[model samples]
Target: MKVVIIFNHPYEGSYCNAILKSTLLGLQIANHQVDVIHLDKENFNPVMRSEDLRAFINKNPIDEKVIEFGDRLKDAEHLIFIFPIWWELMPALMKGFIDKVIFPGVAYDYVNASNTKMKPLWDKVKGITVITTMNTPSILYNWIFGNAIQKALLRGTFWKLGYKNRKWISLNRVKMVSPEKRKKWLTNIESNFSKLK
Candidate 1:
């Protein structure tokens, strides 16, 4: 399987980076071809300019990086997103990647005459897994905050794009969690990914 991991973290010592490392180890053990899109290292621009909006309206992308990312994801068998939740939402660069790379001509297309209905274009993509870390407690994030990440990414974006096998692995209260618990999470993540086929 060709797995694509979209990783977003500015600091090298961040927990998200640790998650990326564990995920890579797992994919390697599984012998899957993996591609990591390190948004912070690449300095991906999350802000959409007027030109980008215009291109989107035309169903075309002018940014070379966006086009390149789209091409990389064109034949992906599985997509894994690793990031931290800031203010109960995804980081800016990850959001920007979605806004720019996961566009109409790249991820899906409208099938109806009114352009209201969409069908996915990435036929090889079987599933999407999102791993998020946050300082907030999981219960609060889910009950009070409404699991915005899942609703926005899984339901709003991927499900609407025609892919339904979506999963979210949310590690909450990272700052408050015990070191042993964090280590356990990393080990489990690595083991689970290694089991992927």
Candidate 2:
């Protein structure tokens, strides 16, 4: 499967980086073609201007980088989101990346679609996986936010676009964990990638 990994962490030495590296290496070992997209490196902007808001009805993504990213999404069979949780959602950059890129017409179509009102844009992709890290405890997030990030990204975005067999693989409580536990968490995600292959 062609897998695209979208990441947004800014620090190279972060535990988030470790998880991403492990995920890629594992996918390589599994012989899956992989592409790594660091949204921060791409200097992705999340904030929308008045023009964008005004053109909301068209939902056309005009940014060049977002266009490139959209092309990759169109071509890939699997998508893996790798990032850290901030306030129970993705970082601002990640959110912006999605905003500027996954436009309504580009990611989905409303005109001449199966639903007439709804169109699935990513039926081309067969699967999705979200590898996320959180500082809060697992139970707290699920209970409070009701897994808000997962439900919003996985069910709201990918599932709406026709992705299947999705997995929200989370490594929780990193801010309070020891180095050894962090390493173990990374290794577990690597193992997951190995299984994906």
Q: Give one digit per residue, the lDDT tens place, for model 1 in 1-197.
A: 99999999999999999999999999999999999999987767788899998988788988888888888889899999999999999988999998888888877788987999998888899889999999998889989999899888998998888887888899989999999999999999999999987
List RMSD in Å for every model shown. Answer: 1.0, 2.3
Clashing pairs in 1: none
Give the alpha carbon lDDT tens digit for every residue of 53-138 in model 2. 65556667666676688777777878888889988889998888777667775677775545445565766677788888888999
RMSD of 1: 1.0
Best by TM-score: 1
Listed in order, each prediction's TM-score against the native is: 0.97, 0.88
Q: Which ten residues in a row are the worst by lDDT in model 1?
A: 40-49
> Which ranges in model 1 have alpha carbons more than 4 Å from their true place?
none
* lDDT top scorer: 1
